[model samples]
Target: MGRRPVHVVGRVIVGLLALALTGCAAPAAPADSALSLGSTAAAAPVALTASATAAARTAKIYSIRTTDATKGVITVIGTLSPAPKTGTRIPLHQWIPSARRWQEVAHGYSSGTSVTIKTVQPGSVRTYRIAVGPQAPYAAAISPMISFKHYVWRGIFKKGLLATGGNATPQFNIVPPKEGPRRAEADLLADKGGYVWGEVNSTGCSFVRNWLGNLTDGTVRTSLHNGRRR
Candidate 1:
């Protein structure tokens, strides 16, 4: 081969130096505990930071989450530590400002460590609580009231978050359920497990069927109505 020119050699050296510099300056990838040598994950249970004050409550209620799946239909869930015994009858209560008492709105049974309660919550924001029965060996307990506000979608700056088929609807409502002095002092949210219970007051829950959109196109809408407490 012919002898390389001095400029060509200089260019090659510069390129090599640039490559080395880039290698040194590149950011390290985040540690993948599954593949990293020194990365480790917690092997023990984590402590919860709930702030519930009740003698009957041996644990804390981390937080409450609400989801609006269909219009006027809402699913309420809560997490708590020291799960309740299965088959325990609990009464879900709603605050009655007029009567100055917590009225039973719905009822649910404990299956696991958490409670899943469904309600048609479309009216003005209302507060809810779960009352655990203290029958026999169990002491009567009440979960911190979680006041859920009705879900409303804001189109401002939120129009571009969804694709044509992508639903930009609310994934979950970011509000607590408790209200007033009996409410949880701090918002202790649990990503996994914490302390929570749920109940319902028979004849206290309500729902309404509503029809919304109708067009030649395949699109549909709903003008659903929520529950009413008497």
Candidate 2:
């Protein structure tokens, strides 16, 4: 009977040891499962990053200059962000008051990130801008408007003048004094404050008196009339 009790104790100890091993092994299952899940999550991020859409490009005109006043030549310089492809077409636009719309005046090709466009426009004051059309993966963009003023030179003198649609009876003889050849030229210019001024110059004979009329919206044309001589 004592041997039977000892055998029963031995079986009980073996059962406890097995239970302890099962408990220890149970904890290891969670640790190994957690490690495997973390590795799977790390690779899942690669699939999440597949083929993202590209960002749109930006365009702007940084400078506009009247490079040649005499020729009325202007240059429009600008840049495109994330630089566009080589030879991309960039167009220059001019605001037409008569049509009340924008007109394409000139165009240039892109070189690196920069583009330079030049056009000759004279005899008017207006607004200008540059634009680029959407060329795949890039959005269409336009630059801010820039104001440009160009003047035309006019001459008035013994190149005798007559009033349009007016009676000619009051005409005074404007013979340049026989002393020398006389000539006069004038142009309408604007100040930085947007004030318009008429400038006149004469060679040989001098203009003794002058007058300038108020600028009105109807003043689409600038005219210089010479009166009296010294």
Winning model by TM-score: 2
Q: How many residue pairs clash in all the candidates, one count each?
A: 21, 0
Q: Write the per-residue lDDT of candidate 2 for residues 121-177, one digit (tens) a residue.
A: 765778988888886666688877888665432234434433322122222233353
RMSD, one per candidate, in order: 29.6, 15.9
lDDT of 2: 0.66
Against the true structure, candidate 2 reaches a TM-score of 0.46
- How many backbone overlaps does candidate 2 show? 0
lDDT of 1 by residue, 51-155 (tens): 122334442234544465333455555543456778666566778888988877666566766666666554457787776665433466677767766653221
